[model samples]
Target: MKRTSSLAIRTASAALTALLALSATACGGSGAPKSRSGGPVWAEGQGATEAVGFMRVQTPAGAAEMKGAVQHGFQDTTYLLSFAASTGDAEAFVADLRPEEALRANIPRDSTTYTTITPWSHLGLPEPETQQKVRTASVCPPCIKDERRSAVQSITIFVQDIGDGRARVYLKAF
Candidate 1:
């Protein structure tokens, strides 16, 4: 009887250990989905790092006209500036942008702007390989001194071709 009780206790302990392990994995161990190449996939609105000033991409001279609008997020303090451009000029506009151009054209006069231009992929975001053509850049502005306000100083820009003589430009700032 003593040996049987000991074996039963051991079996129960083993089952409990297995249950705990499975529970932990089900709760938080699994992470974001991975691509076929074993790289993490950057899902829509999932991977964004902080940036401040907009990337400086020059519009090609005499390219098709462009229109823009600013959109505010409903659930967050994020802001996005969307631009629609002629497909012919979209690639050239993105290519002509200097990596470290000042963002005076988009940011407020008093806002601090960084001179460094970093690729979005460097911030743990996967390249937009699925898009027809895409370019992304980011800048982090200087931090605000006020204690009462929470300022998001990171900005990222994406320029992507959407086909049919149209390209979309997205500037996401948080």
Candidate 2:
């Protein structure tokens, strides 16, 4: 009877994990209207022409409530953005992120294809080496409390390079 109960508990835990994963994927936001390719809108901007794919995410604004994020199309690449609250009561609310999480979450591991997650090195600004550095700026205790508050929504853009060194833009969000 003990063994049977253990099996049931394990099964229940697995089910719960699967449910949470599914729920997280849906947390970013609602899906946009479908196109023939069934992807998000990609007009034109930045180095988008150099992109191969992308993802967009929009998180909810509140307490522990889950936020919304979305993935537009499937490409050889995947990306993820992690938003965390870094500061105090009011100030800690701006949507802050752990870039490392973004890097790891960018690609899905179970798939057979190769997916790459690169930092936006081209943004031309010095990036913080540690997640703390990134989190520190906007999440400081009292600075820009309202504006810096981590309650945020972000859109991460992915692009796959074609033969000509140009990429197709893919959108992902969190």
Candidate 3:
């Protein structure tokens, strides 16, 4: 009887230990989706780190025409940009972007202009390979500091390559 009781107690204690461990692990695990206001939210493994080309504006001389139309009180022109990265570098690219807090803190005191970011797409172009190559993406519209002034910046990104463990980021700004 003594031996049996001891064995029963040991068994129960072991079961309780296992249950506690499992509960703790489950409570500490990550299982929920992440999101940010209206901006794009990056997952754990979005974008690459291989330094795709930088984002910049296209020269006016190169433009086929004077691009831009009135939108939200400003004449915004579409810019062309490009990026290239290895199939696995997408996560790093997205991580390198400025976070929401950083952007808010960096807003220029005199630069009261607001910009909206959205993905740009046109006919014949395939969607960004966020899940496979690009990892993450977003868009930002160029706005003027004052309604009376013309646009002071361009807004457009063009992805052109994703090979040789590198990437390119081109911008077409007017």
Model 1 error, position 159 (Å)? 2.9
TM-scores for candidates 1 onward, in order? 0.32, 0.19, 0.24
Q: Which 10 consecutive positions of candidate 1 have the poorest summed lDDT?
A: 47-56
TM-score of 1: 0.32
* lDDT at position 72, candidate 3: 21
Computed on alpha carbons, the lDDT of every model, listed in order, comes to 0.46, 0.32, 0.34
How does candidate 3 fare on TM-score?
Answer: 0.24
Reference-based lDDT, residue 116, model 1: 20
Give lDDT tens digits, candidate 2, residues 1-174.
999999999999999998877776676433333345544332234232222122222332432211122233354222333222212311322233222122221332333332333332323211223112122221121233434323333333322222233222223332
Model 3 lDDT per residue over 62-118, tens place: 222222211121233333333444423433433333222211111122222333332
* Candidate 2 vs 3: which has more lDDT: 3
Q: Name the runs in model 2 displaced over 4 angstroms.
A: 1-152
Q: What's the CA error at residue 133 for candidate 2, in Å?
A: 28
- Model 2 CA RMSD to the hidden true structure, in angstroms: 17.8
Error of 3 at 150 (Å): 10
- What lDDT score goes with residue 112 in model 3? 29
What TM value does model 2 have?
A: 0.19
**Mind giving the per-residue lDDT tens digits that candidate 1 earns over 1-174?**
999999999999999998987877766666334334423322344321211122223445554323322223433345444455786665555444332443223321221332222223233332232343665665554342322223545555576666787766655555
- Where does model 1 exceed 4 Å of error? 1-12, 15-77, 85-130, 143-150, 160-168
